[model samples]
Target: MEAAFRYREREGDLKAPYEHTEGPYPLGRWLSEQRRTFRAGQMDGERAAELEGLGIVWDTADAAFETNLAAARAYYRLHGTLAAPRGAAILDVQVGQWLTNVRRPGGLGQDPVRAERRAAALAAVDPDWNPAVLGWTVDWQRHYAYLAQLLDEGARLRAVTAGVTRHGEDIGRWLVTQRRDWARLNPEQQARLTALGVTPARVVRARQAPAKKRSTTTSGRGAAAFEAGVQALAQYLAREGGGTPGRSHVERLPDGSEHRTGVWLANQRQRRDRLDTGQLEALAGLGVPWAAS
Candidate 1:
């Protein structure tokens, strides 16, 4: 066994070293020093020799050093910061390009609001694109679409406000309050608008459904009972007042006081420990009354 182990160890020692798959190992902190030297138009003979010893090759010794030094200087000037220590600088270059594309007049434009919105969208899509810098990239087409959408919305809002004679509620505020009414319109309502060749402004108003009247008896009773149950549960949890054990904590006495008592008791039990699925199923099977409101 010892003789076999010795032979295996010798075989392992003779194996070739692992080859680095990618070219141009990152210069990292050495980049700043390299840039300074390049700006001064000088090359370090010792550093060039070290890189060559690590299996990096150049057509000629002086050419290799000059090429490396020039590249380092160019990168630092563009980024205004160091490239990530370990990876290719390709991503950094792409981010720089994306920044430049957004700043052009026809790009995001000089409008502060639109520019800010575009910058935010670009940053969200690609965080490496510092919006403050100038650069260009193909990925900026995505940000262009987003900025276009914002401009469209702004135009629509302006048109809506311009058409409205009343200024009490602005277009944006009215849209927020009426969102649910706008969502609930039927297919027939939508079809009628389409048949008339209706404008977008008319379509916005057409989508709103008529408000329904509230049920005073059922809804009011259910709401009052639920509120009483909540108050009773809070009092029980806090262990407050010298009140009767089964009495609800509501200020107003309910019309059907017995029903409120049942709700309050159930709430108290729920507060102690929540009901399990099996327990809930058992209670449901027993035809226990549940509030509709």
Candidate 2:
């Protein structure tokens, strides 16, 4: 036990090599025996619990998945997406290569249930973990995620200047191209941009008229926010099957950005009186329980 403790302390986990030793003790062999005992139902309950506390991973496959998952989560937290280039790495983990392989069919494993579970775990980390699975390119999703972040931070769409960039993507250029070629975008892309207060170039030019300038901002802001909320709710429904998200639930969008859908839902319920008929109808269409009020 002392050898096990010392090994765990130094190695961060109990998976020592079979030939490993802690001084004179055959700690690796001893740990292997413990696993055998546990599997045979001969190990004491308290002893099993103690080993678990020491991070004794019973299954090597699950352990590998968990280790890689930690690296994926860290990368997502930093870049907001798992769309890593093939050469990308987080510390010692080749997260980019791992993600690339996992995105392929049967790359997780041959076992259906385990593969589904692993895929679900990755999805929980980044809903659009595989951009191809959602009918979009990784680069497109990355750009959209940056735009979503900017909007959520209260940066108006028009204020995204020509030199603006995020993660080396010229978002300002992307925005201009998106607006100029709004018709070139698929319905989903157009809907997402519209939710963020973006419009066609022609409409934008028309709204630049002084007579409509003030009203445009005020009206666009509320409508865009509401549309974003609705889009988030719809996405939640698609991902979770049903039931509302809790207040702390942060929804990862297809573009790799997160939306505080729970908070938005709560705010909507509290301020239901301020919503227009069309907005209310939109929420009701999504089967929001409180929207009927």
Pick the lDDT winner.
2
Question: Which stretches of candidate 1 lie above 4 Å from their native place?
Answer: 1-27, 52-98, 101-293
Lowest lDDT block of 10, candidate 1:
13-22
**Candidate 2 structure, TM-score to reference:** 0.50
Model 2: per-residue Cα lDDT over 138-170, one tens digit each: 656778888888778788877897788877768
The clash numbers for all candidates, in the given order, read: 4, 0
Candidate 1 lDDT score at position 23: 28
Residue by residue across 1-293, what tens digits does model 1's lDDT show?
A: 23223323555421111111112333332333444564465867886554434433232322332333334334444433222122224422443332333333334555677557545644543454332232211222222223233344454434433223221223333333223233232344334333433223334346557755432322456555445554433233212111234444332222434334444555635543343333333333222334210
Candidate 2's displacement at residue 147, Å, is 1.1
Q: Estimate each model's TM-score.
A: 0.18, 0.50
RMSD each, Å: 25.1, 14.7
TM-score of 1: 0.18
Question: Best by TM-score, which number?
Answer: 2
